[model samples]
Target: MRVFTVAEAKAMIPEVRERADVIIRLRANLAELSLTLNTTGESPAGGGVAEMKALEAHLGEAIGWFNGHGIEVKGIAPLLIDFPAVLDGEDVRLCWLEGDERLAWYHRTELGFAGRRRLA
Candidate 1:
Protein backbone atom coordinates (compact mmCIF):
# COMPACT_ATOMS: atom_id res chain seq x y z
CA MET A 1 0.00 0.00 0.00
CA ARG A 2 1.18 3.49 -0.73
CA VAL A 3 1.60 5.63 2.36
CA PHE A 4 1.13 9.35 2.11
CA THR A 5 2.41 11.96 4.44
CA VAL A 6 -0.11 14.26 6.12
CA ALA A 7 1.00 17.21 4.01
CA GLU A 8 0.65 15.17 0.86
CA ALA A 9 -2.82 14.07 1.90
CA LYS A 10 -3.98 17.59 2.75
CA ALA A 11 -2.68 18.86 -0.56
CA MET A 12 -5.04 16.42 -2.27
CA ILE A 13 -8.17 17.66 -0.50
CA PRO A 14 -9.38 20.13 -3.08
CA GLU A 15 -9.24 17.70 -5.97
CA VAL A 16 -10.71 14.92 -3.89
CA ARG A 17 -13.53 17.18 -2.72
CA GLU A 18 -14.36 18.13 -6.27
CA ARG A 19 -14.45 14.52 -7.40
CA ALA A 20 -16.51 13.53 -4.40
CA ASP A 21 -19.03 16.26 -5.21
CA VAL A 22 -19.34 14.93 -8.72
CA ILE A 23 -19.92 11.42 -7.42
CA ILE A 24 -22.52 12.69 -4.98
CA ARG A 25 -24.43 14.36 -7.76
CA LEU A 26 -24.28 11.23 -9.87
CA ARG A 27 -25.41 9.08 -6.95
CA ALA A 28 -28.41 11.34 -6.37
CA ASN A 29 -29.42 11.12 -9.99
CA LEU A 30 -29.07 7.35 -9.96
CA ALA A 31 -31.20 7.09 -6.84
CA GLU A 32 -33.94 9.17 -8.37
CA LEU A 33 -33.86 7.21 -11.58
CA SER A 34 -33.92 3.92 -9.71
CA LEU A 35 -36.93 4.97 -7.63
CA THR A 36 -38.89 6.02 -10.66
CA LEU A 37 -38.02 2.97 -12.70
CA ASN A 38 -38.82 0.59 -9.86
CA THR A 39 -42.21 2.06 -9.00
CA THR A 40 -43.69 3.31 -12.26
CA GLY A 41 -41.22 2.02 -14.85
CA GLU A 42 -40.46 5.50 -16.14
CA SER A 43 -39.43 8.91 -14.88
CA PRO A 44 -41.50 11.98 -15.54
CA ALA A 45 -38.76 14.52 -14.81
CA GLY A 46 -36.29 13.61 -17.57
CA GLY A 47 -34.92 10.40 -16.06
CA GLY A 48 -34.72 7.32 -18.28
CA VAL A 49 -32.49 4.43 -19.20
CA ALA A 50 -30.11 6.58 -21.20
CA GLU A 51 -29.73 9.11 -18.42
CA MET A 52 -29.12 6.33 -15.92
CA LYS A 53 -26.50 4.76 -18.12
CA ALA A 54 -24.71 8.06 -18.49
CA LEU A 55 -24.72 8.70 -14.76
CA GLU A 56 -23.44 5.21 -14.02
CA ALA A 57 -20.74 5.56 -16.60
CA HIS A 58 -19.56 8.80 -15.04
CA LEU A 59 -19.64 7.19 -11.60
CA GLY A 60 -17.49 4.32 -12.78
CA GLU A 61 -15.03 6.72 -14.30
CA ALA A 62 -14.81 8.71 -11.10
CA ILE A 63 -14.23 5.54 -9.06
CA GLY A 64 -11.51 4.51 -11.44
CA TRP A 65 -9.85 7.88 -11.05
CA PHE A 66 -9.84 7.48 -7.30
CA ASN A 67 -8.29 4.05 -7.58
CA GLY A 68 -5.57 5.34 -9.86
CA HIS A 69 -4.81 8.09 -7.37
CA GLY A 70 -4.29 5.58 -4.57
CA ILE A 71 -7.18 6.87 -2.52
CA GLU A 72 -9.39 4.23 -1.01
CA VAL A 73 -13.09 4.78 -1.73
CA LYS A 74 -14.82 3.23 1.25
CA GLY A 75 -18.58 3.71 1.02
CA ILE A 76 -21.24 5.07 -1.28
CA ALA A 77 -24.20 6.36 0.75
CA PRO A 78 -22.14 8.78 2.81
CA LEU A 79 -19.17 8.86 0.47
CA LEU A 80 -16.02 8.05 2.35
CA ILE A 81 -12.34 8.07 1.35
CA ASP A 82 -9.19 7.19 3.21
CA PHE A 83 -5.57 7.85 2.39
CA PRO A 84 -3.04 5.35 3.61
CA ALA A 85 -0.63 7.27 5.77
CA VAL A 86 1.87 6.99 8.58
CA LEU A 87 1.78 9.52 11.37
CA ASP A 88 4.00 9.76 14.42
CA GLY A 89 5.60 6.48 13.45
CA GLU A 90 2.31 4.62 13.44
CA ASP A 91 0.16 3.48 10.53
CA VAL A 92 -3.05 5.39 10.05
CA ARG A 93 -5.66 6.22 7.49
CA LEU A 94 -6.48 9.82 6.79
CA CYS A 95 -10.25 9.83 6.67
CA TRP A 96 -12.60 12.04 4.72
CA LEU A 97 -16.39 11.75 4.82
CA GLU A 98 -18.95 13.19 2.40
CA GLY A 99 -19.61 16.39 4.35
CA ASP A 100 -16.10 17.15 5.41
CA GLU A 101 -14.60 20.31 3.95
CA ARG A 102 -11.05 19.51 4.95
CA LEU A 103 -8.70 16.62 5.62
CA ALA A 104 -8.62 16.92 9.38
CA TRP A 105 -9.17 13.44 10.67
CA TYR A 106 -7.50 10.05 10.78
CA HIS A 107 -7.80 6.60 12.29
CA ARG A 108 -5.66 3.60 13.07
CA THR A 109 -5.90 0.82 10.51
CA GLU A 110 -7.55 -1.71 12.82
CA LEU A 111 -10.22 0.61 14.24
CA GLY A 112 -12.10 1.70 11.11
CA PHE A 113 -14.17 4.90 11.22
CA ALA A 114 -15.25 4.24 14.76
CA GLY A 115 -11.77 5.31 15.76
CA ARG A 116 -11.53 8.51 13.77
CA ARG A 117 -9.46 11.21 15.47
CA ARG A 118 -8.84 14.82 14.67
CA LEU A 119 -5.50 15.68 13.10
CA ALA A 120 -3.31 17.87 15.21
Candidate 2:
Protein backbone atom coordinates (compact mmCIF):
# COMPACT_ATOMS: atom_id res chain seq x y z
CA MET A 1 0.00 0.00 0.00
CA ARG A 2 2.90 2.33 -0.48
CA VAL A 3 1.98 5.52 -2.32
CA PHE A 4 4.30 7.02 -4.90
CA THR A 5 4.81 10.32 -6.64
CA VAL A 6 4.66 10.58 -10.41
CA ALA A 7 8.40 10.84 -10.65
CA GLU A 8 9.00 7.86 -8.44
CA ALA A 9 6.61 5.74 -10.41
CA LYS A 10 7.95 6.83 -13.76
CA ALA A 11 11.45 6.04 -12.60
CA MET A 12 10.36 2.45 -12.29
CA ILE A 13 9.84 2.20 -16.04
CA PRO A 14 12.95 0.07 -16.47
CA GLU A 15 12.01 -2.43 -13.81
CA VAL A 16 8.49 -2.43 -15.08
CA ARG A 17 9.64 -3.23 -18.56
CA GLU A 18 11.67 -6.15 -17.30
CA ARG A 19 8.78 -7.47 -15.29
CA ALA A 20 6.59 -7.06 -18.33
CA ASP A 21 8.91 -9.19 -20.39
CA VAL A 22 8.78 -11.96 -17.85
CA ILE A 23 5.01 -11.73 -17.71
CA ILE A 24 4.73 -12.04 -21.45
CA ARG A 25 6.91 -15.12 -21.53
CA LEU A 26 5.10 -16.68 -18.62
CA ARG A 27 1.75 -16.04 -20.22
CA ALA A 28 2.83 -17.58 -23.47
CA ASN A 29 4.11 -20.61 -21.64
CA LEU A 30 0.87 -20.81 -19.75
CA ALA A 31 -1.04 -20.84 -23.00
CA GLU A 32 1.09 -23.70 -24.23
CA LEU A 33 0.47 -25.53 -21.02
CA SER A 34 -3.24 -25.00 -21.41
CA LEU A 35 -3.16 -26.44 -24.88
CA THR A 36 -1.30 -29.45 -23.59
CA LEU A 37 -3.89 -29.94 -20.91
CA ASN A 38 -6.68 -29.69 -23.44
CA THR A 39 -5.08 -32.25 -25.72
CA THR A 40 -3.80 -34.72 -23.19
CA GLY A 41 -6.31 -34.04 -20.43
CA GLU A 42 -3.32 -33.94 -18.14
CA SER A 43 -0.13 -32.05 -17.56
CA PRO A 44 3.29 -33.29 -18.55
CA ALA A 45 5.48 -34.92 -15.92
CA GLY A 46 6.72 -31.66 -14.42
CA GLY A 47 3.95 -29.49 -15.80
CA GLY A 48 1.44 -30.61 -13.23
CA VAL A 49 -1.37 -28.58 -11.73
CA ALA A 50 1.23 -27.32 -9.30
CA GLU A 51 3.05 -25.68 -12.18
CA MET A 52 -0.10 -23.83 -13.14
CA LYS A 53 -0.58 -22.74 -9.58
CA ALA A 54 3.00 -21.52 -9.50
CA LEU A 55 2.44 -19.46 -12.61
CA GLU A 56 -0.61 -17.92 -11.03
CA ALA A 57 1.38 -17.12 -7.96
CA HIS A 58 4.09 -15.54 -10.06
CA LEU A 59 1.59 -13.44 -11.94
CA GLY A 60 -0.09 -12.39 -8.75
CA GLU A 61 3.22 -11.42 -7.19
CA ALA A 62 4.19 -9.39 -10.20
CA ILE A 63 0.84 -7.62 -10.29
CA GLY A 64 0.86 -7.05 -6.56
CA TRP A 65 4.37 -5.65 -6.73
CA PHE A 66 3.34 -3.26 -9.45
CA ASN A 67 0.30 -2.25 -7.44
CA GLY A 68 2.47 -1.57 -4.44
CA HIS A 69 4.59 0.68 -6.62
CA GLY A 70 1.53 2.79 -7.49
CA ILE A 71 0.60 1.37 -10.86
CA GLU A 72 -2.85 -0.09 -11.29
CA VAL A 73 -2.85 -3.74 -12.33
CA LYS A 74 -4.96 -3.66 -15.42
CA GLY A 75 -5.84 -6.65 -17.58
CA ILE A 76 -3.03 -9.10 -18.17
CA ALA A 77 -4.14 -9.87 -21.70
CA PRO A 78 -3.99 -6.35 -23.12
CA LEU A 79 -1.40 -5.31 -20.55
CA LEU A 80 -2.79 -1.98 -19.48
CA ILE A 81 -1.17 -0.43 -16.41
CA ASP A 82 -2.44 2.91 -15.17
CA PHE A 83 -0.59 5.39 -13.03
CA PRO A 84 -0.44 8.92 -11.61
CA ALA A 85 -0.97 6.82 -8.51
CA VAL A 86 -3.58 8.42 -6.36
CA LEU A 87 -7.22 9.18 -6.04
CA ASP A 88 -7.80 11.93 -3.51
CA GLY A 89 -4.60 10.84 -1.75
CA GLU A 90 -6.10 7.41 -1.25
CA ASP A 91 -5.43 4.83 -3.90
CA VAL A 92 -8.93 4.29 -5.20
CA ARG A 93 -8.81 3.00 -8.75
CA LEU A 94 -7.13 -0.16 -9.97
CA CYS A 95 -7.35 -1.39 -13.55
CA TRP A 96 -9.97 1.17 -14.44
CA LEU A 97 -8.69 3.02 -17.46
CA GLU A 98 -10.25 3.06 -20.91
CA GLY A 99 -7.28 2.56 -23.17
CA ASP A 100 -3.70 1.37 -23.06
CA GLU A 101 -2.09 4.34 -24.74
CA ARG A 102 -4.35 6.68 -22.81
CA LEU A 103 -1.76 6.90 -20.07
CA ALA A 104 -0.24 9.84 -21.85
CA TRP A 105 -3.57 11.64 -21.97
CA TYR A 106 -5.09 10.38 -18.75
CA HIS A 107 -5.03 12.25 -15.45
CA ARG A 108 -3.50 11.59 -12.08
CA THR A 109 -5.53 11.40 -8.89
CA GLU A 110 -5.65 15.12 -8.23
CA LEU A 111 -5.87 16.18 -11.84
CA GLY A 112 -8.44 15.12 -14.34
CA PHE A 113 -7.57 14.34 -17.95
CA ALA A 114 -7.79 18.03 -18.64
CA GLY A 115 -4.79 18.37 -16.38
CA ARG A 116 -2.91 15.35 -17.67
CA ARG A 117 0.75 16.03 -18.02
CA ARG A 118 3.64 14.24 -19.63
CA LEU A 119 5.46 11.81 -17.34
CA ALA A 120 8.49 13.92 -16.64
Candidate 3:
Protein backbone atom coordinates (compact mmCIF):
# COMPACT_ATOMS: atom_id res chain seq x y z
CA MET A 1 0.00 0.00 0.00
CA ARG A 2 1.23 3.48 -0.80
CA VAL A 3 0.91 5.66 2.24
CA PHE A 4 0.53 9.32 1.34
CA THR A 5 1.17 12.38 3.41
CA VAL A 6 -1.56 15.01 3.63
CA ALA A 7 0.45 17.26 1.38
CA GLU A 8 0.87 14.54 -1.17
CA ALA A 9 -2.82 13.77 -1.21
CA LYS A 10 -3.77 17.41 -1.42
CA ALA A 11 -1.38 17.94 -4.24
CA MET A 12 -3.39 15.61 -6.40
CA ILE A 13 -6.77 17.10 -5.64
CA PRO A 14 -7.17 18.82 -9.00
CA GLU A 15 -6.35 15.70 -10.96
CA VAL A 16 -8.58 13.66 -8.72
CA ARG A 17 -11.48 16.02 -9.21
CA GLU A 18 -11.02 15.96 -12.96
CA ARG A 19 -11.02 12.19 -13.07
CA ALA A 20 -13.99 12.05 -10.75
CA ASP A 21 -15.90 14.31 -13.09
CA VAL A 22 -15.18 12.01 -16.01
CA ILE A 23 -16.23 8.96 -14.02
CA ILE A 24 -19.38 10.68 -12.90
CA ARG A 25 -20.34 11.53 -16.46
CA LEU A 26 -19.54 8.04 -17.71
CA ARG A 27 -21.55 6.45 -14.93
CA ALA A 28 -24.53 8.61 -15.80
CA ASN A 29 -24.25 7.56 -19.41
CA LEU A 30 -24.02 3.89 -18.46
CA ALA A 31 -27.02 4.16 -16.15
CA GLU A 32 -29.05 5.79 -18.90
CA LEU A 33 -28.04 3.03 -21.26
CA SER A 34 -29.02 0.37 -18.74
CA LEU A 35 -32.39 2.01 -18.15
CA THR A 36 -33.15 2.13 -21.83
CA LEU A 37 -31.95 -1.40 -22.38
CA ASN A 38 -34.11 -2.67 -19.55
CA THR A 39 -37.18 -0.61 -20.43
CA THR A 40 -37.90 -1.23 -24.08
CA GLY A 41 -35.13 -3.74 -24.88
CA GLU A 42 -33.39 -1.17 -27.02
CA SER A 43 -31.50 2.05 -26.56
CA PRO A 44 -32.57 5.25 -28.28
CA ALA A 45 -28.95 6.38 -28.07
CA GLY A 46 -27.85 3.66 -30.47
CA GLY A 47 -26.68 1.74 -27.44
CA GLY A 48 -26.29 -1.67 -28.99
CA VAL A 49 -23.76 -4.12 -27.58
CA ALA A 50 -20.89 -2.05 -28.93
CA GLU A 51 -22.12 1.22 -27.43
CA MET A 52 -22.72 -0.36 -24.04
CA LYS A 53 -19.33 -2.02 -24.14
CA ALA A 54 -17.66 1.27 -24.99
CA LEU A 55 -19.27 3.02 -22.07
CA GLU A 56 -18.31 0.16 -19.77
CA ALA A 57 -14.81 0.23 -21.12
CA HIS A 58 -14.48 3.96 -20.55
CA LEU A 59 -15.84 3.65 -17.06
CA GLY A 60 -13.49 0.79 -16.30
CA GLU A 61 -10.56 2.73 -17.64
CA ALA A 62 -11.40 5.80 -15.55
CA ILE A 63 -11.75 3.77 -12.34
CA GLY A 64 -8.69 1.73 -13.17
CA TRP A 65 -6.67 4.94 -13.39
CA PHE A 66 -7.08 5.39 -9.66
CA ASN A 67 -6.20 1.77 -8.92
CA GLY A 68 -3.10 2.11 -11.00
CA HIS A 69 -2.15 5.14 -8.93
CA GLY A 70 -2.52 3.09 -5.71
CA ILE A 71 -5.59 5.01 -4.60
CA GLU A 72 -8.46 2.94 -3.20
CA VAL A 73 -11.85 3.36 -4.78
CA LYS A 74 -14.44 2.89 -2.04
CA GLY A 75 -17.60 3.67 -4.01
CA ILE A 76 -18.63 4.54 -7.53
CA ALA A 77 -22.19 5.65 -6.95
CA PRO A 78 -20.96 8.80 -5.23
CA LEU A 79 -17.33 8.40 -6.24
CA LEU A 80 -15.62 8.01 -2.90
CA ILE A 81 -11.85 7.52 -2.95
CA ASP A 82 -9.19 7.12 -0.32
CA PHE A 83 -5.49 7.55 -0.19
CA PRO A 84 -3.76 5.30 2.30
CA ALA A 85 -1.99 7.57 4.73
CA VAL A 86 -0.63 7.75 8.24
CA LEU A 87 -1.25 10.81 10.33
CA ASP A 88 0.36 11.39 13.70
CA GLY A 89 1.80 7.88 13.64
CA GLU A 90 -1.58 6.20 13.15
CA ASP A 91 -2.79 4.72 9.92
CA VAL A 92 -5.76 6.42 8.30
CA ARG A 93 -7.27 7.18 4.97
CA LEU A 94 -7.41 10.65 3.44
CA CYS A 95 -10.81 10.61 1.83
CA TRP A 96 -12.44 12.38 -1.08
CA LEU A 97 -15.94 12.04 -2.47
CA GLU A 98 -17.65 13.37 -5.54
CA GLY A 99 -18.75 17.02 -5.19
CA ASP A 100 -16.00 17.79 -2.68
CA GLU A 101 -13.91 20.70 -3.85
CA ARG A 102 -10.90 19.88 -1.74
CA LEU A 103 -9.13 17.03 0.05
CA ALA A 104 -10.08 17.90 3.60
CA TRP A 105 -11.46 14.81 5.24
CA TYR A 106 -10.04 11.67 6.80
CA HIS A 107 -10.86 8.67 8.94
CA ARG A 108 -9.13 5.75 10.52
CA THR A 109 -8.89 2.79 8.23
CA GLU A 110 -11.21 0.76 10.43
CA LEU A 111 -13.89 3.42 10.80
CA GLY A 112 -14.62 4.13 7.17
CA PHE A 113 -16.50 7.18 5.92
CA ALA A 114 -18.93 7.12 8.80
CA GLY A 115 -16.09 8.22 11.01
CA ARG A 116 -14.87 10.96 8.76
CA ARG A 117 -13.68 14.16 10.38
CA ARG A 118 -12.51 17.41 8.94
CA LEU A 119 -8.77 17.58 8.45
CA ALA A 120 -7.15 19.79 11.07
Candidate 4:
Protein backbone atom coordinates (compact mmCIF):
# COMPACT_ATOMS: atom_id res chain seq x y z
CA MET A 1 0.00 0.00 0.00
CA ARG A 2 1.31 3.42 -0.81
CA VAL A 3 1.17 6.14 1.81
CA PHE A 4 1.08 9.74 0.75
CA THR A 5 1.93 12.85 2.70
CA VAL A 6 -0.78 15.47 3.10
CA ALA A 7 0.85 17.66 0.53
CA GLU A 8 1.19 14.83 -1.89
CA ALA A 9 -2.44 13.93 -1.58
CA LYS A 10 -3.50 17.53 -1.96
CA ALA A 11 -1.44 17.88 -5.07
CA MET A 12 -3.21 14.96 -6.63
CA ILE A 13 -6.63 16.56 -6.31
CA PRO A 14 -6.81 18.09 -9.77
CA GLU A 15 -6.21 14.84 -11.57
CA VAL A 16 -8.52 13.08 -9.17
CA ARG A 17 -11.21 15.63 -9.83
CA GLU A 18 -10.97 15.08 -13.56
CA ARG A 19 -11.23 11.35 -13.24
CA ALA A 20 -14.03 11.63 -10.74
CA ASP A 21 -16.09 13.63 -13.19
CA VAL A 22 -15.76 10.92 -15.79
CA ILE A 23 -16.72 8.28 -13.28
CA ILE A 24 -19.77 10.17 -12.08
CA ARG A 25 -21.04 10.72 -15.60
CA LEU A 26 -20.52 7.11 -16.59
CA ARG A 27 -22.22 5.84 -13.48
CA ALA A 28 -25.22 8.03 -14.14
CA ASN A 29 -25.48 6.65 -17.65
CA LEU A 30 -25.21 3.10 -16.40
CA ALA A 31 -27.88 3.67 -13.80
CA GLU A 32 -30.21 5.06 -16.44
CA LEU A 33 -29.58 2.06 -18.68
CA SER A 34 -30.23 -0.30 -15.79
CA LEU A 35 -33.55 1.39 -15.08
CA THR A 36 -34.53 1.12 -18.70
CA LEU A 37 -33.68 -2.55 -18.78
CA ASN A 38 -35.63 -3.19 -15.62
CA THR A 39 -38.70 -1.40 -16.88
CA THR A 40 -38.64 -3.08 -20.27
CA GLY A 41 -37.86 -6.53 -18.87
CA GLU A 42 -35.39 -6.88 -21.69
CA SER A 43 -32.38 -5.17 -23.19
CA PRO A 44 -33.13 -2.30 -25.53
CA ALA A 45 -33.57 -3.44 -29.12
CA GLY A 46 -30.32 -2.02 -30.49
CA GLY A 47 -27.27 -3.43 -28.71
CA GLY A 48 -28.32 -2.44 -25.18
CA VAL A 49 -26.28 -5.30 -23.78
CA ALA A 50 -23.27 -4.10 -25.69
CA GLU A 51 -23.77 -0.55 -24.51
CA MET A 52 -24.02 -1.68 -20.92
CA LYS A 53 -20.90 -3.75 -21.33
CA ALA A 54 -19.01 -0.81 -22.74
CA LEU A 55 -20.20 1.44 -19.93
CA GLU A 56 -19.15 -1.13 -17.36
CA ALA A 57 -15.78 -1.41 -19.00
CA HIS A 58 -15.34 2.33 -18.98
CA LEU A 59 -16.33 2.54 -15.31
CA GLY A 60 -13.85 -0.21 -14.48
CA GLU A 61 -11.11 1.59 -16.32
CA ALA A 62 -11.91 4.83 -14.55
CA ILE A 63 -11.79 3.06 -11.19
CA GLY A 64 -8.62 1.22 -12.16
CA TRP A 65 -6.97 4.52 -12.88
CA PHE A 66 -7.44 5.53 -9.26
CA ASN A 67 -6.32 2.18 -7.88
CA GLY A 68 -3.23 2.27 -10.03
CA HIS A 69 -2.32 5.53 -8.36
CA GLY A 70 -2.79 4.13 -4.84
CA ILE A 71 -6.07 5.89 -4.22
CA GLU A 72 -8.86 3.84 -2.69
CA VAL A 73 -12.37 4.29 -4.02
CA LYS A 74 -14.98 3.88 -1.33
CA GLY A 75 -18.21 4.82 -3.11
CA ILE A 76 -19.24 5.59 -6.69
CA ALA A 77 -22.37 7.71 -6.45
CA PRO A 78 -20.75 10.36 -4.32
CA LEU A 79 -17.25 9.51 -5.42
CA LEU A 80 -15.62 8.89 -2.09
CA ILE A 81 -11.87 8.46 -2.27
CA ASP A 82 -9.27 7.80 0.36
CA PHE A 83 -5.58 8.47 0.17
CA PRO A 84 -3.42 6.48 2.53
CA ALA A 85 -1.52 8.75 4.83
CA VAL A 86 0.25 8.85 8.14
CA LEU A 87 -1.19 11.07 10.81
CA ASP A 88 0.49 11.47 14.20
CA GLY A 89 2.57 8.41 13.30
CA GLU A 90 -0.44 6.21 12.70
CA ASP A 91 -1.75 5.27 9.32
CA VAL A 92 -5.06 6.82 8.30
CA ARG A 93 -6.97 7.90 5.26
CA LEU A 94 -7.18 11.37 3.84
CA CYS A 95 -10.70 11.53 2.58
CA TRP A 96 -12.12 13.53 -0.30
CA LEU A 97 -15.65 13.45 -1.57
CA GLU A 98 -16.68 14.28 -5.14
CA GLY A 99 -17.90 17.83 -4.62
CA ASP A 100 -15.33 18.97 -2.12
CA GLU A 101 -12.89 21.60 -3.28
CA ARG A 102 -9.93 20.12 -1.41
CA LEU A 103 -8.78 17.44 0.95
CA ALA A 104 -10.19 18.56 4.26
CA TRP A 105 -11.02 15.41 6.12
CA TYR A 106 -9.53 12.17 7.35
CA HIS A 107 -10.33 9.22 9.54
CA ARG A 108 -8.85 6.16 11.18
CA THR A 109 -8.33 3.19 8.94
CA GLU A 110 -11.06 1.13 10.53
CA LEU A 111 -13.60 3.88 11.13
CA GLY A 112 -14.49 4.91 7.58
CA PHE A 113 -16.15 8.15 6.51
CA ALA A 114 -18.47 8.47 9.41
CA GLY A 115 -15.40 8.86 11.56
CA ARG A 116 -13.90 11.57 9.47
CA ARG A 117 -12.35 14.56 11.20
CA ARG A 118 -11.25 17.83 9.80
CA LEU A 119 -7.62 17.85 8.78
CA ALA A 120 -5.72 20.18 11.06
Candidate number of the best lDDT: 3
The sequence of per-residue lDDT tens digits that candidate 2 reaches over residues 55-86 is 87887787787777667765777565666455
Candidate 1 C-alpha lDDT tens digits along 87-120: 8889899999999999999999889999999999
For model 3, how does the per-residue alpha-carbon lDDT over 18-45 read when each residue is reduced to its tens digit? 9999999999999988888878788886
lDDT of 3 at 75: 98
Per-prediction TM-score: 0.91, 0.64, 0.96, 0.94
Model 3: lDDT to the true structure: 0.94
**Candidate 4 collision pairs:** none
Q: What is every candidate's alpha-carbon RMSD to the true fold?
A: 1.6, 5.2, 0.9, 1.5
lDDT against the true structure, each candidate: 0.90, 0.61, 0.94, 0.93
Judged by TM-score, which candidate is best?
3
TM-score of 1: 0.91
**Which stretch of 10 consecutive residues in model 4 shows the poorest summed lDDT?**
40-49
Better of 1 and 4 by lDDT: 4
- Please give the distance, in angstroms, between residue 44's alpha carbon in candidate 4 and its true position after superposition: 6.8
Itemize residue pairs with steric clashes in candidate 3.
none
How far out, in Å, is residue 44 in model 2? Answer: 3.8
